[model samples]
Target: MQWFLLGVALLISGYFIYGKIIERIFGTRPERQTPAFTNNDGVDYVPMSTRKVYLVQLLNIAGLGPIFGPILGALYGPTALLWIVFGSIFAGAVHDYFSGMLSVRAGGASVPTVVGRELGTAAKHFMNSFAVLLLLLVGVVFTLGPAKLLGNLSGTSVPVWVAVIFGYYLIATLVPIDKIIGRLYPLFGALLVFMSVGLLIGLAVSDKSFYAAGITLENLHPQDLPLWPLLFITIACGALSGFHATQSPLMARCMENESNGRFVFYGAMIGEGVIALIWATLGMSFYDSPEALNATLAQGGPAAVVNDVATSLLGGIGGILAILGVVVLPITSGDTSFRAARLILSDFLKFDQKPITKRLMIALPLFAVGFAISLMDFNVIWRYFGWANQMTAVIMLWAAAAWLKRHGKFHWVCTVPATFMTGVVNAYLFSAEIGFGLPLSVAGPIGLASSSVMLVWLLMRGRREQDDLDTPAIAAEQA
Candidate 1:
């Protein structure tokens, strides 16, 4: 309990302290016109109030992530709380801030475009394909999830719900941002807040004690999995996520000022971290032990745990509403996933999105592919998403580091986390069933070596560029 309160306190304080430092390093220029003004297409580039944008950004990057991911991460005990707090403050929020702000600076370019500009053309092309596929996957996965839930709730078939959701996705994708998403998301955001806060209140009043006293740093996994990379990957969205990088650009196009980047981007990630912390605390407290939590998770999955916890804590009607809030999570993010995909394709094709026909030209194929993927067994494909998601974070972080270096601001804030995640992703890739399937001894060293190589290359290259920029100034001073 103390740990939970301390975690919440740190997350809020970090937003004010560390978040401001990041905002300063980015040097947001309020006087400079933003994409909302410069590229006012009324489709994606419409101006929105700061509060609305913050809520929209929060909903965009957060789906079932902060809830589901942290529930899983809680198997690691109180240490999960630490990761959610520190990771969000130091790494996740920073990653989100730069991803969004860089897009705003680039006239609201997509994540791939921002990455390509800083990381080079090769990266741009790779990320273009990677981000589109990831977004399509997000669209399909979120569609299937909500459809299944709605199907069970309404006694409708999964296919019917899928078609219904896909249709909504199309409408949401095609309409102007201010029309559907901007109007409805604040309500969704309210439900999300209510769910989290309600659960916190429930825990406070509960007869049973939830927090385990003096939880240790020791590995608490039932399967005895190493705590290093797996925990990090499991807690991606709540701590750090590459998926947020893709979503941030959607709001970047709608933002009216650069100064709002701190609140909208970094603040959103912190909000998500708090959500993650609540769930993690609940997961640890609600169950008897990590083993009991593991047993329940295996039998009914995270959704079952969510249903049980919410109902048990809040009672019938309140619990149902809380569950509805959970339902809203994926739906809000799913629409934006397709919308982000549409924007990414439009940017890659150099097509104007102002025209409805042009929007369809790009959007139709994306939905087609998403629909097709939805039909097949996607569990195997979904298994790979965790790794792909984190890898995207690594790329975006490096791009942010590069941007900082280019601008001569403090780059380590981005570079340190970028390099650390580089190792994490690499280690996961090597050890997981999806990748090389090597022993941890082999995989850990490989990950370390890979990150070391990247760090050396970035440092050497940055120094050369700095020297090149300085040479002319030095010569002019001498003359």
Candidate 2:
């Protein structure tokens, strides 16, 4: 309990302190016009207030990642708390702030365009496909999961619910930003907040021993999985998810001023970190031990555990409402995932989205691909998402580091975390069954080598760019 409280405090403090530092480093200019106003299309680039954009951005990235990821991460014990606190403060928030702000500066471009501007054309092309694929995966996964849940609740079939949800996604994808998403998101945001806060109060009032033991760095996984890279990968969203980079630009297009970038982007990530912290604490404290939680997870998955906890902690009606909040998470993210895919494809093809026909030209093909993938086994597709998600973050962070270096700001703020996650994702790729399936002894060093190469290249490039900037000044002084 002490650890959880301290973690929450640290996350809030991070927003005020570390958040401001990054905001200053990015040099947000309130006087400048934002893309939302300059490039207002009434569709994706519609202007919105800071408060509305903050909630929209929060829901855009929250998804099931924070809730499910941390519940799984709790298998590693209290060490999960440390990662949630530090990772969000330093890495995740920084990644989000820059991703959104860079997009805002680039006239509401997608993540690929932002990366291309800083990292070069090759990166832009790779990210264009990579980000679109991830968003589609998110859309499909979120779709099936929610459809299945609604099926169970309503006594309908999964296929029926799926068609209904996909239909909603199509409309949300095609419509103006202010029409559906902008209006409904605040209510969704309210439900999410109520659920988390209600659970916290429930924990306080319950007689159950919520804290199994004092905070420990020891591995508590019943399966005895190694903590190094596995814990980090399992707890991506709360810590430092790459997926947020793809989602940040969605809100970036709606921002009214450059100054709102920190509050809407960085602060929203911090808000997500809080949600992750609550879920992790619940996973740890609700069960008798790590073994018990593992058994529960194995038996019914994250949603089952969420149901048991909410029902036990809150009463019947409250618990049902809380569970509804959880359902809202994936659905909200799914619609935006498709929405973002449409925007990314439009940016890539240089197609105008003002016409509904043009929006359908990109969106129809995406849903066709998403619906096809939805028919296959979901677990196989999700296995790649965690790794791919972190991989995207690594790219975005390096791009941000490059942008900072070019502007003579503090690049280390991004470079350090970028190098760390680069190693983490690579390490997961090599060690996990999805990739090489190598032992950690070999994979760990390989990951280190990969990150080291990136860090060295970044430093050398920063030096060259700095020298280029200095050359004109030197010639003037000499004259």
Which ranges of candidate 2 are over 4 A from the true structure?
463-479
Off by over 4 Å in 1: 376-378, 463-479
Q: Supply candidate 2's per-residue lDDT for 290.
A: 85
Q: Pick the candidate with the highest TM-score.
A: 2
How would you encode candidate 1's per-residue C-alpha lDDT over 270-328 as one tens digit per residue?
99898899899999989988899998889767777888888899998888878888788
lDDT agreement with native, every candidate: 0.86, 0.87
Please state every model's RMSD to the true fold in angstroms: 4.7, 4.7
Alpha carbon deviation, residue 56, candidate 1 (Å) = 0.5
Tell me the TM-score of model 1: 0.94
The TM-score measured for candidate 2 stands at: 0.95
Q: Lowest-lDDT window of 10 residues in candidate 1? A: 468-477
lDDT score of residue 428 within candidate 2: 89
TM-score of each: 0.94, 0.95
